[model samples]
Target chain A: MEEFEPKIVAFCCHYCAYSAADLAGSMRLQYPPNIRIVEMPCSGTIDHRVILDAFEKGADGVYVAGCMEGDCHFLKGNYRAKKRVNYVKKVLAEIGLESERLEFFNLSAAMGPRFAEIANEMTERIKKLGPSPLRRKGEEK
Target chain B: MIVAQQKPLEEIARLINDCQKVLLVGCAGCVTVCLAGGEKETEFLASALRIKRQLEGNPLETVTFTCTRQCDPEYLLPLDNLIGDVDAVVSLACGVGVQYIAERYPHKWVVPALDTKFAGGSLEQGVWAERCGLCGNCILHLTGGICPVIRCSKSILNGPCGGSQDGKCEIARDVDCAWQLIYDRMKALGKLERLMEIMPPKDWSTARDGGPRRAVREDVIIDA
Candidate 1:
């Protein structure tokens, strides 16, 4: 039997990480297919609910990918994203969910290989941690 | 403003456990301005709880309402209809708003959705830093608008102790020296002479030490 694959959601900022992921695909880089990409105008636009909803909807892991620090297209959108991500992590921990399920990453649009690396790394980490405890009803087990 | 943030989704869900109908109330006053409890947040929480309930095989109905100010009785009156029908009310307000709801509807269950922090202002667009202690006293004039009671970390009246180094606070490496900011601001305003004036130690009795402080004004009172 195949091992249970974690369903991961990647909230990518349109300015950088989304483009980087596309570049990774063009480069034919191998990464986990279980990851789903949601392109957002800026990582800052990613609401707290998006992270919670991902878990509520059976996602085993979620990660936000934004532009490198000080490189945000919207001045301090990435900084806001970082703060919200930290706040969400604390919220998850307080609610009995594994805080590690959510993560924030920064990289330039040119870092295609970096995107592939993160996909593989996050996939490995989630597989080790098992499925998200908040997975929708029957999705668990 | 009284800054606050929402409690964890699941924790909030558990708090209202067994309530089939929930009235998710948001405050449009301080909490809304701070982005802790507002209409958007109320919707977000209601939807999350709905999902959690569905997954647990227990159906739940959430009704969201935002009041001008949950801490005031007039604004709370609008929730009267919803309150009578819902199993519980989840207040996405500060500590004061939570208590206000409880006090107004003594028989209803009022649950807190956010953790009440302190009187502070945003350092940037989304970052909030403590700015005032609201020790029931006003000493900002003497401190050059820099609040020593709150921002100083030690709440020291005479600060920037010998422990201060390179403008950074000794107690915490990341915190800037509050007293230094006060000194600089006062000096820039040509009020350096005021620093020589000694301020007596703060009297705790005038604060929470007074046991539930109250204020009354005969001029503002109206009698039938």
Candidate 2:
């Protein structure tokens, strides 16, 4: 049995999470490299289709990083993203995946350390869960 | 509009689990406006079902299509070529779409993904409230646009029953008294005098009591 290396997809908002990622890089913050970040104009644009599509495409874990409460660049984009994340969690459970495989985090662009923390936290969670159930027999690596 | 809500994903998956491949159809009509069934939803469900089956070691193939309106015959004709070879069909439209698909392709299995709720309008971004009873009669002129038939718990025709309290129905605190809305609107319009006339019992025949109903316009008929 080979080691299970999880594939995690991160949907990051341009106004906050994306900038926070840039700051994390500049600050020399260390985090897991498993996550593949997809930049978005706003977390509010997160669609259930896209999140589910990630799982369908063999993402072992997924997360949406948005602005903190009451600090969204578009007034309530993070709030809207929170609602959509909660919704997709239920659907993931229905599809036999642990709802914990999906998550939503709120942060500000200045919170570089916090961004690294979220990445480490999500990585640990996915590592414990192993590969996604949909991962084919010989593809977990 | 016919408001609807999607059924849980587990139940929908169970309905089509025996099939190897299926078509997931969406309607661009009322269900779309209600955010229940649309092109996006159709693709989402197809993906969810595929993931569910794949997790179980049984891969499911899905084809998706969005019809203009499933209830109309012409709008459904495009599916003639798309329905081939699928073991079953999952419709995300309202109940009407499910039944229409079943009738059109009698040899194939048809499943409904939405629970047809009511003939109503959107109350807010994601909320909907029933506003009409579809009783085959026009009574809005008498009730000042507030329909006591569907809005009222008892469907009282003439006056508010004793269940009304503080502008709310006794059945639930969240339910507004339909008669209260009628009174407020009529008074605002200075049409309170109209309420003074003793109303007669409604003729039940015009409603569903007459059995399945149909409406036809001879002028619009075209020889086939």
> For every candidate, what share of the true interface contacts is present?
0.17, 0.90
Instruction: Give the clashing residue pairs of candidate 1, or none.
Output: none
Per residue, candidate 1 scores C-alpha lDDT tens digits across B152-208 of: 878889776887788889888889899988888988999999988888989987778
Cα-based lDDT for every prediction: 0.87, 0.91
Among the numbered candidates, top lDDT falls to: 2
The true-versus-predicted C-alpha distance at residue B99 of model 2, in Å, is 1.8
Cα lDDT of candidate 2 equals 0.91
Candidate 1 chain B least-lDDT 10 residues: B47-56
C-alpha lDDT of residue A141 in model 2: 62
TM-score for predicted model 1 compared with the true structure: 0.68
lDDT of 2 at B192: 98
